[model samples]
Target: MLSILKDFLLNLFFILIPIFIVPIWIEEKNIPKHIKRHLLTVCFALVIILCMTIPVDADREFISDLRQIPLWLGSLYKGAATSMFLCLVTIGYRSLFGGTGFFVTVIISLFIMVIGIALEKKFLALSSKHRVLLATALCTFSGILSIVLAQTFHRIPLSSDISLAYLSVQPICMLITCSLKEMIYKNIALRKRIIRAEKMEAVSHLAASISHEIRNPLTAARGFMQLLEQHHLSPEKRKQYVRIAIEELDRAEAIITDYLTFAKPAPESIEKLNVKTEIERVIDLLRPLANMNSVEVKTTLAPFTIIGEREKFRQCLLNIMKNAIEAMPNGGVLQIYVSIEKQHVLIRITDTGIGMTKEQIERLGEPYFTTKGIKGTGLGMMVVYRIIESMNGTIHIKSEIHKGTEVSIYLPLSSNLHDLTNEEKKLFMAL
Candidate 1:
């Protein structure tokens, strides 16, 4: 009995190794279905050979092992052609050790294969739990049929303990092996579903972002076009409105180009950007808006360097500063400061605007969350967060209601910045 138990465990170990390995291996390699089926057939054939090569001897009159489990599994999964091939392999291999029992093995194997093929479609259509139950039932029936046929044909005398061991162990082995294979297949299917869902969600987000970003400049251009209908306007005023409209249209074009670059499969362009140069450019661009709102712009920018894509970094800064400017509808100060701290270049933008609550602050970068209500699409900060994260940087926000808000951005200092002398760095900072 102990010997039978050990043999059963050994057979199970050999069978399980390939059962678990083949699916993951083939999935990673992106193997085709037809080829994958053949690979499974070959692997299971090897397992069958291992099981047959080392048979469990009970009283020397009975020879048995768990070879039927793999045969049944292959039949149910790989279709009729594969089942036929495995059947041939089993019959051919068993013929080597000729006996009356060989004929019994042949008869029993054919019986199981026929039943398995008949139920293959039904088994596949069943839900996971039902499939496991049905397969287990089939295996148990096959075991019973084998015992009855063996007694009728070979008349091999077997002790009660050995018979009990054979009956109990084989069905249990079948149940376990079938259950594990089913679970693995189920998990693989679930993972594929999750990956597909994530991809669809990303595409939806990209579409929304492109729509939101392009809408602003287009809206601006439309407003200027509406203003151009006036018949009494000065020549210079009319020309200024036309130029601004054209610039707004050009910005819309640039935005579409940026989004196309983002959606492309090619790699993004990264470069070391001078902090002062980029921030000053954005500040200059928004200077007119600041003046229009009676908001004062103050800066203490240093020529610190950080690594990131030029457009994305500029976009991130623009969103942050634009929000700061908009926050102060009643005309307040927007302070920008930059310095190196603990090997990181820190960008601190402070605004004397109507501030936010802790709850609002925590939800800043979440999609469609905004302090500006209907006037905001709420994607700007989300874009800022994603771009900063891509550059391996972090943003920290501090705000108190009716007082002010400060946003601190920390990015790793560029390696080239280390080569600059302290005096040169100071001179650059002063500039």
Candidate 2:
């Protein structure tokens, strides 16, 4: 009795462990479906063979083992093809034992295979609780059939203790294993759904950000082209308009390329950026727009070094200064100043324009909330907020209606000064 119970428990572990653990590996998208299916079939076949190799009682002419559990599970959960293969394996293995019970094993396996194949569709369609009940019922029926056939066909004597134990334990083990498999399947399906939803959300955000960024340069280019259409414009002015238009188009292309870097497999390169050089580049690009709005550009820039992506840094500066110029349609002073404050680089951009209300300022970075109304998507400041945060920086805006607005950005100073040449270090010190 002790030995039979030990064998039964060992058999139970074989079926249950893999059912719980293998789903995690097989659920990965990288594994092809046919490969996953083959892997599962091989796993269950091994479990079936292990149960058969160690029979419950080596002395009995008619051996009993819990091999049918995995066979039935594979069939009901998978389909008829797996059922046919498992039935063949069970019969073939039992034939090697050379006993009257081998024929009985053949009959029972075939009967269960037929039943499993027939009811597989309904078994899968059932709820988890119902599936467990049905599987347990089927296992119990197979146990009863084995006992009746053994007695009627060959009058083989059976131990009452072993029979009772098999009847009770087989159904219970089937119930436990089936319930666990159903639970794992439910969780895996839910996880896949959540991952898909998160991917969709990321794509939506990227689309909105790219559209907003590209529109800025395109809008500026359109403005320059409009200026060039004036028939009475001087030759020099037309040439200047065409140059600014070409530069704006190039800026638009660069913005598209920058956004695409997020999709690449490799990490983007980060470098030490000179604040003065990048800021001046942005100012030079936006100079045409500033002149159109009659806004005077004044800068007090220093060559402070910071760590970030250079294009993103330039995009941030361009967005802020463009907004400042647009704020003052009737002409005003756009002042940009850079200095060191504590352990950070401070960039202050103040505009003498129609400033914003406290309410407007609070809503600055909210998506699609704009004082420019139809002309703005409100994503520019949103991008600014994201980039600054990614660089471990902070931005503060102080504005009052009819007064002026001051935008202050604080970025941590790059600490790798050893990379700079002596001349560069001297230039930094002089500034």
Candidate 3:
């Protein structure tokens, strides 16, 4: 019994090593998640096959080797397709060996896959103590039965005491694995959350500093520009100078507004705003700039109602649309679409422009990060992100290097922002 327990611990440790080894090969956010998923699945399968070659000997009979760990984990986390592949591999590997318990291996392997798929969600929700016990119980029964069937049908010699050792050791091994997995993952999650909180704190501080440091000078410059407009010389020259001054001042004001907005929390102003009307107004405001850049602006705006401040919504649309228009230096089509979905309003903006890389997209809402070098203050999109978040809405931006960019925003059709239940709020935030 002592020897069997020791082997069980050793077997499970080796099985888990391949799983934990994935962190070294694939860092979070470094590779696309789907690719990482596939790679990890392959790695876990390889480890399982390797473990299958080394079985625990009980009175010179097979008892345990942690064969079920990969099968069960792959199903629970990697989903059906990967789990099915693992099942096939396990069956094939056992058949290739073809010593004894072949039929029992195939039957129990099939049972594991079936149970894994059926109980994945319920099992995940279980407490660690219960989850480990339940899973371990199933694996233990199948393992002991495999030994029994081997002795009965395949004429392999086995002892009853060895089966008892399998029963005793399997649950202990599973409990240890479960505890370690939960602890490691929880620590990782906590670390990520702490990093995120720190980043947000830094953003708030920077926004405050920028707003206070630059706003007054920008206001003074704008006022001087307004005074100069009164004592004009030539119509064309005055117009050009005034235009340049005002444009520069407006740029300064935009930067100031972006930071100020970030530093402050949004006020509670909930009203039923017409999405189509507000969007049309923004399009009109940007028509001249769009025309100047030779970029065509077209919209398929459906009448949709959402709870938000009208000016805030207008400002949000203006910043986003302006960014879209500017993306097309050589001019391209900027398309806007608004539609009503189940309980929300959907606004999608697509621009045929230079587009952005994956890294640029990931860095979109950072305080000082900018895709456009000198021309961008990086706050336009930052303000856009804040507005959407405060409105209890969500935004998704997809871009390719040269193909183009598409941004989709979803806002719930509620009486007020506070009306959103926790679940609905999560839905929008997840969007």
Q: Quantify all predictions' global Cα lDDT against the true fold.
A: 0.83, 0.83, 0.75
Q: Over the stretch 15-132, how does candidate 3's per-residue lDDT look in tens digits? A: 6785566654466647787888888788778867776777666222233467777776677656777778888988898777665556676777788788778876788788766766
- Ranked by TM-score, the better of candidates 1 and 2 is 1
Residue range 1-431, candidate 1, lDDT tens digits = 68778988998998898789999999899999889989999988888888888976633334688888898888887778778888888888887877777777798779867876788688788888887787788888887777777787768444555566778888888889888998899899999999999989978987887688789889999998888899998889899999999988887786565455444442289998999999999999999989988899999877777888888888889989999999999999999999887678899999999999999999998765779975665667877887888888999999999888999999998865457668537754554
Put the candidates in TM-score order, highest first. Answer: 1, 2, 3
- Which tens-of-lDDT digit does each residue in 1-431 have in candidate 2? 78778889999999987898788877765678898887888888888888889767543457778888998898888789898888888888888886777877899889878988898798889888998898889898998888888777667456677777788888888988988988898899999899999889977976877787789889999999998879999999999999989988987775565454434433257899989999999999999999999999999988888999888788789889989999999999999999877658899999999999999999887555668875664567866776787788999999988878999999998865566557546655665
Worst 10 residues of 2 by lDDT: 258-267
Off by over 4 Å in 1: 58-62, 158-160, 265-431
Each prediction's Cα RMSD?
A: 8.1, 10.3, 15.2
Worst 10 residues of 3 by lDDT: 56-65
Winner on lDDT (1 vs 3):
1
Angstrom error of the Cα, residue 306, model 2: value is 30
TM-score for each prediction?
0.61, 0.60, 0.50
Q: How well does model 1 score by local distance difference test?
A: 0.83
Measured with C-alpha atoms, the lDDT of residue 323 in candidate 3 is 87
Candidate 3's error at 272, in angstroms?
A: 54
